[model samples]
Target: MMLKDKMRQLGRRDFLRYSAAGAGALMAPGLVRPARAETAGLTMHTWSAAVDTVQSHLSAFTAETGIPVNYGNSPWAQYREGMVAKFVGGAPLDAMWVSDSWLPEWAEAGWIAPVDEFDSLMKYNAEAEDFCTQSMTYGGRQYGLTYYTDYMAFLYDEAKLKEAGFDAPPSSWDELVEQSRVMKEKGIAEYPMMLAMAQESWLIEFISTLVYSHGGRLVDDSGSAVMQDSKEGAVEALQWVVDAVDKHKIVSPACVETGELAGLKSFAAGNHAFAMVAKYRLRMLNDPAQSQIAGNVKQAMMPQGANGSHATVGWMRFHGMSTQAAQDKARAENTAKLIEWFGGKSDGAYTFQKLLFLDIGAGFGVKPLFEDPEIRAAYDSYGDVNMIQAQQALARKKDTITPWFGEWNDTNGSAWQSAILGNVDAAGAVKKSADLWNELKDSY
Candidate 1:
């Protein structure tokens, strides 16, 4: 059945439920404490990626500032849904994690308030990557301080490339296809390119990376949908994936069912010669204990398309103040201090950002952290620092981030998946996606 038809049959709510289920393997929701009394110091919420590290930092913040924190987290898959529930139920919240894509929606709903008045937080913009600062801003006002930021990156097994008689990674998508074919024919690998195209939270990032690298924009500068344009649009990008699966057979048909975490495990098992993944995964990919292909994995610029540069999509999560917390003068002040502590500096250092990078290989927004010997040495251990910096220089923020993003991403992802699965052509898929985008924009 067609994607739109299937979604209609299942209903939008059921489709989202199904999509959420696909990410369940990554993590289960953790217990979130009920909203604390107003007399309590502060309350914070985050997705369950770096719980231990965040708790440790929170502990230190409390020790130094005498501000007790009630911290909690849910799995990333359910984070947005859970946060919305909390907002509607009037749950007490002070500071919380917010994705860049959710900024317009949350701000418009009055769930999150601007932090532009906090000079302590604003001062760090001078030292942050432009992408980080820009992502944290919405509609002329800055909403939060960056918790973490990273771009999608193309990666490959250097050992596999060499074994396939190639000296370096592909610079273009066509070259990648040629390399994958040789690897498959030589029995070096089967389905040599790993892509997680599943309709989950990670789906939009993956799609955006492809679209941007292919020199296409889902939405133009004037905030209009252009993804269906015959030239320089999302069709060119989606067509590449469809061709990769159906024509070249370099990527598995099962990719539509694979989420990012599962694809990571598959690549780490040395089952694929090339993959597109989050830049931070390099740390896990090169860890001998976690990855069988350790020390062989290498980062490369995202392969370009015919009219494209090597650009890829970048995203950020920030520490945002809850509207409830911002209404109270003292609470807002304390929350800003907490935000500065975690997102900017802690005890005269980029402590949390540095710790986050060192702990899980997550990227930081702070540019000065790149110069730190400790951080430099750590990147050298698992990756090429020069290559990492070069690729980051090419990172671009997703253009489709708007108030209607959450609703449109669902349709866009499903449409792309349909094309990949051969249920629709690339033109049909992108047309469907662009149509919805335009409808959403008009309504907004």
Candidate 2:
């Protein structure tokens, strides 16, 4: 059966039981190597993204290093559960892609091994974005190198703003409401703001961006839930969103049903004057072939809240080594090379990062990449180089990531959505989220 079906059969409780049992077995001494040929080299796995580009890169790695590789991929939605099954089942694996949210759980579960001893890999941290390095590190040990990273960004339809007689995007949240009201009154747009508030994976990132930009946090450094504090940024930030949707009527009620991709499509179609979306979408929005608002789409700093700065939330996925691969010295060496080849330097430069960015508009974690003339030129074509760099410098990682994040996030997303729908007050929504966060943390 497929991994998803297996997960369904096992259920969440059973899946945790399975992972717990697997953890015990993984921790035992004398791990047997998979029954692959000694000369077969490495087995790499990834989600089915940029397949042609990844295959081309893999072919180049083999041609240059003379290392045979067996690469395979599954759909992204199924990848996490599939990887867990593989980890528990001891499938042949060397390097694989890992999302940041899974780091704590995977690390604690012994599914992935840290690469702190590898100086070649460690050297990249000096050049990487702080959060990318931080996100890869868990329990004080760095796991692997970053595959890609991006931040949520505030974007606007320039033509719509201009038609509404605005010279520039709003600098503050209140200003945004004022400008949106003007755009609405002018008939530039019925719903002048676009916010995808659906209960999905993207919801947390959206929530974090709003909270961070408003100078609020869901949790503090002690890992205690502070989202319930009205003095903190959460309540105010959420209240702004609530007012925007109900009182201002600037954001469509349909936002509760919108997913990130759908919101991107709507923004690209020029149906909304302003939007909060992933920074990478700017490339797609500016592509004439894909977007109706191409050339008229522009990026702006995340609007500030009364007490917040222009901070936004950032996230990353990385190439991590399997505990199975790390157990053997030779295999560990080869696995690190493969990871470094893709995540670090390939052919004496950040060839893969550049290629990935040029091919699909993905962001890189390395600081030097921003200085590359070609990368600069490409970004300049679709965005302001200064603004892009400026906003990225202000990005922070999500504060709620923990071993229990997956369980808590579902409740958190639902709580925020309830508030947005006016089913609960903002304070009540935050309290509900905070309660679950504290409960989960205490259990941990």
Candidate 3:
């Protein structure tokens, strides 16, 4: 059945029910009073999961320091715009959820407090250090704290590939194209891979990975726009997608209308042999109730570029304290204690284990979680695929962890989407994106 047809059969209540079931796995015990309310009047702005996670660990924090959390839960979209408005209006929150992409804008606006001031608040492991330093720092000052990190990688259906006579996965971009072609020819799958190109977020994912894989940098040291508009490497990388849809015909037709969630669903349903997905999709693929290819699903690092670089896009969400919030040294200390109790080594390990069991995706920022025997064992069952992906990501020479400007989402994102949709040639699309980026750069 067409994905669109399947989606039309799904009612809104069905999606809500699915979400409820998913959340049930992570739901915490009801809120209980701390022994002492050290931070009696502090409020925080974040998404619902953070609130739940924080609440789950509140008891430990209370035992350490009595800080009653006045937690606020808002959707990510609202948090960014609403928090900015509140901060600009002089009604800043004590702390809020901040993603890596928002760092430049928020840091430049001076709305967030320096993380160094909260040194005693939390501690990060070495794995966190290996992630990305620029994510939390700006102007030589740390402005945010990260609890989780996410990246885009390829998820594959191991059983389906074996059926197609492949004992191993593709190692390079050329190999991916060749294998995808063979997968289609053998009737192994309608489309071997599902690429998320419908929404702006997915478009960014596609472009960021392609650019990085091809030894292309989106911005220079001084934050100037720098993409190759007429390079063979860039053209070759872009052509891979063009051929996937237009030539090899290995991508679903619904790709134009499918969003991130829908693409994940298509892959989980065993309609595609592989998918370009966020770390979180691991969970969906493991849920026997939701996935047809349960044990068959495995993850692999993205294919290498012509230059032999293994580049993938890293996306992270961070936490930041508000500058306008009244500073209560005692309350801040208690909040820090709470963050540490939930996001520190022990909690991070727990989160990683849960993620592995649920296959929801990879843990956000903590790398040490991989060292856990159970975690490593779970991934090992998939035949070292996860390890290879991680190693490739680590081996990549450059990382595009710079803060994205507002115009980036509005302009560059749109142009990339246009190219993916076949509305513009690759060179034309990149040149347009570069021009828009330069314009945004000058305005800043």
TM-score of each: 0.89, 0.91, 0.80
lDDT of 1: 0.91
**Residue 197 lDDT (model 3):** 73
- At residue 25, candidate 2 shows an lDDT of 88
Predicted candidate 1 versus true structure: per-residue lDDT over 347-427, tens digit per residue? 899999999998878898888888899999999999998888888878888888899998899999989999998899999
Off by over 4 Å in 1: 1-38
The residue pairs found clashing in candidate 2 are 214-308
Residue 31 accuracy (lDDT) in model 3: 38
lDDT of 2 by residue, 1-444 (tens): 899987678778887898998997888766544556554889999999888989999999899888888999999999999999999898889999999999999999999999989998999999999999988988899999989999999999999888989899998999999999999899889998999998889999999999998999989988899999997899998999899999999999898899999999998888899999999999999999999999988899999998899999999999999998999999999899999999999878998888999999999999999999999999999999889999999999888888999999999888988999999999999999999999988998
lDDT of 3 by residue, 1-444 (tens): 999999999999999999897787557444333323344455666765644445555544555455555666777656678777777776535667677667777878777766666555335634464444456777777765565666676678999889888898887777877888888888888789888777555666676776666656566767666664545345556666777787778876567678888888888888888887875666668668889998887777777777736667676666677665426665556555544554453443445224423343445456555566776676565436355346435532123334446556667666655776789987777778777777766766
lDDT of model 1 at position 342: 91
Quote the positional error of residue 96 for candidate 3 in Å.
Answer: 1.9
Clashing pairs in 1: none
Kindly report which residue stretches of model 2 are placed more than 4 angstroms away from their true locations once superposed. 1-39
Clashing pairs in 3: 38-66, 148-364, 149-364, 149-365, 279-361, 280-360, 282-359, 283-359, 283-360
Rate residue 280 of model 1 by lDDT. 92
